[model samples]
Target: MTSTTASRPVGAKPAQGSNLSLGSLLRRPEAGAFLGLLAVLIFFAAFGGLTFLKPAGMSSWLNVAANLGIIAIPVGLLMIAGELDISVGAMVPFGAMTVAVISGHYGMSIWLGIAVTMAFGVTVGLINGYMVIRTAVPSLIVTLGSLFAVQGIVLGLTVLITKSTSVALTVDGPAKVIFGDFLFGGQLQVMVIWWLVLTAAYVFFIHFSPKGNWIFAMGGDKVSARNAGIPTDRMTIVLFVLSSTSAAFVGMCQAILYNSAQVAGGQSFIFNSIISVVVGGVLLTGGFGSVVGIFFGTITFAIVNQGIYYTDFDRNWSALIIGVLLLLAVLMNNTFRKMALSATTKKKGA
Candidate 1:
C-alpha cells in the first residue's frame, strides 16, 4: 500500500512567485484607472487652481458622478457578466415617459405611474434577455436593435399620446422630499448619497456572495460554468434585466428631480456610460473587474469630462482629454488581459 501510494499521481506544488501583497496591481487592469484618476486630480489641482478643490467644484463633479454612476454601475455589471445593454439609453426615456404619460396626461395616481414605469422596464429587460439567450445572439447586436426599436416606440407613442416630445411633471410632497432634498451644502444632491450607498452594497454583494461568484464565473467562461452547474442562461438574463431596471429607476428619479421628462433625455448616456465603465477597469470582453473600480472610474470620468470646462483650456480640449483617456484605458485593458492569461498559464505549468 505504501509503494502504491508513492507511485500515485499527485498535483505539482504551487509555484513560488513574488510576495507582493494583493498581487501586482500594475498587472491588474484597474491599476491604470486608479493611477489615471490620481494623475487627473493632481493635474487639476496644480493647474485648475484652488477652485478645483473647493466645495463648489466638489459639488459639480459629485453631481455628475451621481447622475452618471447609476448607469455606469449596471453597465459595469453587465460587462463583467459578459454582456451589454445599449438599450439602456432608450430604457431611461421609456421609463420616464411612461411615468409622465400615465401620471401627467392620463390622470393616474403617482404610485400607479411609478409601478407602470418599473413594470415596463422589467418587461423590456425580460424580452431583451430572452431573445439573447434563446437565440444566442450577441448582446451588442440584440441591444443595439432594442435601442433603436425602443427609441422609435417611445418617440411615436409619446407623440401619439401627448402630441409633444416633452412632458412636464408636477411632483410634490414625498416625491420632492425624496429627490430634491439636500444633505450637505446647497450643492450636494440626494442622488449623490444614493450612488455611494448603492456602490458600497454592490461591492459587498459582488465580492462576498456566491451569486456574485457565479456571475464572474459565467462571464469568465460560460461553458465551464454550465458544466460546473452554474445557470449561465438565467444569470445572463437576470443581468440584462437588472441593467434595464436600474436605468429605468434612474430615469424615474431624474423625472422627479427635474419635474419633466423629454424623449431625448438619455441619448448621451449610451456612450458616456460605456466610456465611464471602460475607464473604471471593467473589460468590454467581460469578467475580471470590481464595483469599487467602477465607482472610482465613474467619478474620474465625471470630473475629467465636466471639469475641463472650468479650466482655462478650451472646451474642445475636453473631447481631446476624453479620447486620450479612452485610448489609455484600452491599452491598460490589453496589458491586464495578457497578465491574467499568463497567470492561467503559470498555474497550469505549476
Candidate 2:
C-alpha cells in the first residue's frame, strides 16, 4: 500500500547513528554476539580441546561462515527494512543452476552465465515484490510459495534439459579466479572479502544515510512510515530485489567454487540464515536489529555448524546442541530487550 507523509507519529526523530564512546562499545549492536562467540569458543575448547582452535579447523568454520554471511548480510538489511524473502533458499539453486546451464551445458562464457543469473534474480525478486504489494499477502507466505515453486521449476527444468539432477561445471576460468580463489594466505576464500565489504557498506549506509532512517521507519510501522513521507512500497521492493540478487550472486559463486550445482543444494540456507539473523538479535516481529550483531551471529552459527564435525560427538548431537543454542539466544535476546527497555523507562522517569 502507498503511504503518504501525514500519518507518522509526531516527534519521531530520525534514527540516529551510533554515538561512539567507551560506553558506546558496550551498547554496540553486536556486543552480545561478541560475547556469545567467546562463550562458544570457551565451550568448544574446554570440551573439544586443542582441535577446536587449530588453524585448519578455524579456516573451515570461517569458510562456511563467509558463505552464509554473504546472504545473511543482505537478508538482515531486508529484515531491517521490514520485509522478508524466503525465496532465497530456492534462488540459491536457481542461480547456480542457471550458471551451470549457461556455462556448463551450453558452452557459454561464465561471465555471460553470471549476468543471466543476476537478471533472473532481479526478475524473481520483482515478481515477489509485486505479488506481495498487490495481494497484501504477508511476505512469509508469498516467498514461501516462491521457494517451493522455484525449487520445483529448477528441478523439473534441470531434469528436462539435462536429464540429470546434477550438472558438473568446468569452472576453470576468470570467473572462478574472481570468486573462488583463495586469499588471506590461502586460508580464506575470496567470498570472505566480499562479505566484509558488504557488511561495511551496509553498516555505513544504514548508519549514515537518511534512507536508512526510512528503512527503520518502514519496519516500525509501514502505514505510519508512509504517512511520514517515506516511500515504503518502493523501499520494500528494493529490499526484496536486493535480497534475491544477493542470493543469486552467492549461488553463482558456489557453483563455481564447488564446480557443480544440485537442485537441492540451497535447502539448508533457509533455516541457517534465519538462525544467524535471530542470533544477531533481530526480532522476528521486525523493527529492531543490528547488522554487526548478525555478522558475529553468522560467525557463531558457522562455528557451531561446521565445528561440531571436528569433535567426536555424534552428528545427531550437533542438532541438539544447535537447538539449545537457538533457545539460549532467544532467551538472552528477550532478557536484554527487557533490560534495555527498563533502563529507558527509568531514565525517562528520572
Candidate 3:
C-alpha cells in the first residue's frame, strides 16, 4: 500500500493525452489536405462573400469536383502504388464514343453499350498493365502510348461510322435516373452522390483492408514488396484497370447526362486529374496519400477554379489565382509532411 505506482490491468493500453492525440491527428495523410481545404474555403469566403457560399455557387464547384474526384482517386491510388496512367485521357472519349456509337447510332440497348464500353476500358487497362510489367518500360511512356492510340481509334471510328465528330443519345429509363439525373432542385448532379459513395468505398479499401498495405509496400519498394509475396504484378494490373475504367465511367456518365458525346472532349482529364491528385497531397515519387486527401484536394481545386467567378477579381486572373492557390497547397502539404516525419523521429528517439 506504501507504493506510489499506480496499478494497471494486464494488456491495458496507456491513455493518450490531448497533445498526443493532436500530434497523431496531424500525422495522418489527410491532415495537410484538410488544412489546405480549410485555408482555401476561408480565402474564398473572404473575397467572394456570401454568394460564393450559396447553394448555387457551391453546386458549380461541387459538380466539377465530383467529376474530377472520381478520376483523381484511382489515379492517386496508382500514383501511391508507384505507377501512373495518363491513358485515362483517351479512355474518356473512347468510352463516350463506344457507348454513343452502340446505343445512339445503332439504336442498340444502352445496357449493351455500357457493357461494351466498360469492356474496352478493361482491355486497354490490361494492355497498359501487361506492357508496363513485362517490358520494363516506364509506366508513363506505356500509358502515353495508349493515350494517343486510343484517341486515334476514337476519332477514326467516330468519323468513319457516323460521319460526324459528335453523337447524340436519348435515354428514357432507369439508366437515365441512375447515372445522369440531377438532384435537389437540379442544383447538383447525381454524380456527386456517386462520388461520395465511391470515396467512402475507396477510403475503406485503402485504410481498412489488408490489400491496402500491399499498395503502400509496392509503392515503397516494388522489389522488396514482391519478395514479401504481395502479388505486386496483379495489384499493378488491378490499379490500372480501376484507373482506366473509372475514366471510362465518367465519360459514359457525361455522355448520358449531356445527351451527346464528342470525340474531341475529355483530353483535359489527364492534366486535371494529375493536378487534383498532387494537390491532394500524394507524393509524386509515390508511397504516400489517402483517398480523403484526394477528396479534399479535388474540392480545393474546384473551389479555386469556380471561386473566381464569384469574386470581384478580373476573370482573366482566374488562372493565376488557381496556380497560386495550388502552389500554396502543395507547399503546405510538404511542410506538414516534414513536420510529421520530424515528430515521428523524435518520438522514436524518445
By TM-score, who's the top model here? 3
- Model 2: per-residue Cα lDDT over 212-269, one tens digit each: 7888788889889999998887888888888888888888888888889888878788
Scored against the true structure, residue 63 in model 1 reaches a CA lDDT of 84
C-alpha RMSD of each candidate structure in angstroms: 6.0, 5.8, 4.8
lDDT score, residue 180, model 3? 80
Please identify model 2 stretches exceeding 4 Å from their true place: 1-28, 184-187, 347-350
Comparison by lDDT, 2 against 3, better one = 3
For each candidate in the order shown, give its overall lDDT on alpha carbons.
0.81, 0.81, 0.87
After TM-score superposition, what is the CA distance of residue 325 in candidate 1 from its true location, in Å? 0.4
Sorting all predicted structures by TM-score, with the top scorer first, yields 3, 2, 1
TM-score of each: 0.89, 0.89, 0.93
Candidate 3 local lDDT, residue 106 = 96
Q: Name the runs in model 1 displaced over 4 angstroms.
A: 1-23, 337-350
User: Whole-model lDDT, candidate 3?
Assistant: 0.87
| Per-residue alpha-carbon lDDT of candidate 3 for residues 1-350, written as tens digits (9 for 90 to 100) | 01222554475345423333577667667777788788878888899886767889988999999998999999999999999999999998898889999999998999999999999989999999999999999999999999999999999999999999999998768998888878855778899999999999998899888889899889999999999999999999999999999999999988998899999878888888888888888888889888888998899888888988988988798778667767876787788788877985666453
Collision pairs in model 3? none
